[model samples]
Target: MITLGHAQAIIAGAIAHAQNAALKPLGIVVLDAGGQLLAFARQDGASFGRFAIAQAKAHGALAMGDDTAVLAERAKGNPVFFGSLVGVFDGGLALSPGGVLVRNGDGAIIGAVGASGDTGPNDADAVRAGIAAAGFATGAAA
Candidate 1:
């Protein structure tokens, strides 16, 4: 059960973290465990289609129950299957490292967050910061 406040905090924290770190402008998305969009933001100067990238990252994490980093590694060994999934998911799956699953204190999954507009590791770091700021723990990278 992710509240509106939680979503806002994630977005704000992600943006602030990116800014403070001097990373490029970012686009971020948050989604409930059911893959429903909760909150999104694209920082000024972000490239076009950032929203889609962010959305795909978040949706991929939520749908597969794995962080995007794990998915990326799996995809490398299973390109054919991953390609099929891309079509099946309507291009809403990204095998990248910026997606992370959100968890409550009890370790139940609550939602996911994804960040774009920087290096993959940096994007992931920003999301981690945001989730932490929102008072949630991150699940294991798997």
Candidate 2:
């Protein structure tokens, strides 16, 4: 279960990681297993669009039960379906590479974390740092 504290911890850790890496100001979003937003934060200079992109990426991760980067790779093989899904879901799904699913030691999904306002790899790394800091595992497959 993802309590409020857990959500906040994830966001805080992600933000810290971003700052430590000297990355751009980032927007971070946390979502529960049900795909509901649990917590969110935008850094001082983060762009307005970062919030939506971060949320969409996290939502996409939770929806597909996989990392957003994996989904993005899969989308490349089936653009039509993925493109249609964007329209169907009111653009709530993003196949970008900034989303990471949060899991437990037993590998059960608890939630997701997403970051934006930097390159895809940097965003993903920040999210991973947060999940690790919160004592949770990341759902991205090896």
By lDDT, the best candidate is 1
What are the runs in model 2 whose C-alpha is more than 4 Å off? Answer: 140-142
Error of 2 at 79 (Å): 0.9
**Each model's TM-score, in the order given?**
0.95, 0.95
Instruction: Give per-residue CA lDDT, model 2, range 1-142, as digits (tens).
Output: 8888998988888989998999999999999999888999999999999989999899888877898899899999999998888887788788889999999877888888888999988999999998888888996444
Candidate 1: worst 10 consecutive residues by lDDT?
Answer: 133-142
Candidate 1 overall Cα lDDT vs. reference? Answer: 0.90
- Model 2 misses residue 96 by how many Å? 1.0
Model 1: per-residue Cα lDDT over 81-107, one tens digit each? 988988889988888899999998888
**Candidates' C-alpha lDDT:** 0.90, 0.89
